[model samples]
Target: MSLTPSSSTAPAAADPLTPLLTELESALGSVQAALSQRDALALERHAASVQRLMTDALREGRERGRGGDLTPALRQRLAAAGAQVAAQRAALGRATAALDRAIDVLMPPEPLGLYGQSGRTLRQRSSGDVASA
Candidate 1:
């Protein structure tokens, strides 16, 4: 065999976490977009995707003998994603509270004495006499 170096370019080995991180970032972006648009169906789908990705990541970590310990890059990405989710949750909570306040103002609840124990509003009877004595 000749000892001369070959001129052909060889592909480098890829980091196993690269694809998982990429897909996770994509799913996170989709989730954020769905939240912004208030699309429940899209949100559900993307959220499931995110959950699946997380499960896969956990499995990968275990398989790699890391026992749930991730590389710095993976940890950073996950932390950012977690912060994004938390911010989204806070925004949603604020919006829901605002809507609840508006609804309360528009449709005030009955007073304590107005509603029966069973929770239905008691109907007021007419003052007019219904029958002669």
Candidate 2:
């Protein structure tokens, strides 16, 4: 009797990097959410996770390439995810800059020195002395 298993009975091989890509996508989504909510803690946590996942994904991709298994679709997905992450980062930077400007306007910087070089206290003058009115 034959002992070979049929194709229907054999399990399909899974792509090693698919899970990592999915995880990276999830982390990116979390980062976006954290940014929108202005939650620094969550943003930091998710950003770190995304970095780790990206490193792992790159390693896996290289391995797959060596094995001649890397697909174009996978590459496209990775590129798209990277673009999204970059966009989110830019948006966060702009928002932080705007916030800093607003804070600066609300609370101006203090003067470094209160006295002038002539041994006189520097003060804002209400009127200036001039020859003509």
Candidate 3:
């Protein structure tokens, strides 16, 4: 009947945020596994899920600011999860760069113009020029 949150209601309010945090951690793990396997498709899917979870978590946290404080254990777990995600992201970047280099090596750029035996650009001949048979 009161506008203020009772102790009992506080826990219930914080409950939603907990699952978001858990989902984020799980998504990070999936991302790491995908990266290890070099599965780009799976990595992209997991990354998108992680992003969604993060946005939801941030919004929930802000809304619950008036509810209560997060437990120290949860805070620590969140920090560890975030660090793991960052490390995996750096690894992904390196892997992508290596892949790009490999592709470049396999498919080199084409030359622009035709060259002569003397290494000079060949000029087009006019129809009026006669051939020395």
Candidate 4:
């Protein structure tokens, strides 16, 4: 609705959607960035337009009290939109992971390694490490 995320976020305003909306923004940005590079497109660009539209429509539906067709119609549309949102987010995640792996494959290992622990090859230990700690 508002171009600015929030009034006080002078730098980073808040969206009415709040945290979930914020996370959604972050996820979308990642997808966009990943698409910006590479010779061929391997990712999808999805906007939160559907969710925003449904949210706005739902708000309007609430204005009309009991026995309103708007509510049911909104519900049906929202159900479909929700499914799309889930699928898009899942695909974006997969694409992002694939991009990361691709980047790792493309970038040669630095002498000091990524985070500077040269001898210690970064590897994931078992879940036991968490419990042990």
Q: Please tell me which model should have the higher TM-score, number 2 or number 3.
A: 2
lDDT tens per residue, model 4, 1-133: 4755554465223223234334444544544555455312333333544355546544643553344433354445445546656766686579668866775576545565445763324422222234533
Q: After superposition, how far is residue 112 of candidate 4 from its true place, in Å?
A: 2.2
Q: lDDT score, residue 68, model 4?
A: 49
Question: What is the RMSD of candidate 4?
Answer: 14.2
The top-ranked prediction according to lDDT is 2
Q: Give the lowest summed-lDDT range of ten residues in model 1.
A: 4-13
lDDT of 4: 0.48
For 30-133, candidate 1 gives per-residue lDDT tens digits of: 98898889898998899899889867765665565465435677667666766766776787689778866775576565566766543433222311223520
For candidate 3, which ten residues in a row score worst on lDDT?
A: 120-129
- Give each model's clash number: 0, 0, 0, 4
Off by over 4 Å in 1: 1-16, 58-70, 120-133
lDDT of model 4, residue 79:
52
lDDT digits (tens) for residues 1-133 of candidate 3: 5646586787767588688888898998899888889888999999999889877876766566556566666667666766877888788789878876775576444355534333222222321223611
Candidates' TM-scores? 0.60, 0.70, 0.65, 0.42
CA lDDT of each candidate? 0.66, 0.75, 0.71, 0.48
Tell me model 1's lDDT, rounded to 2 decimals.
Answer: 0.66
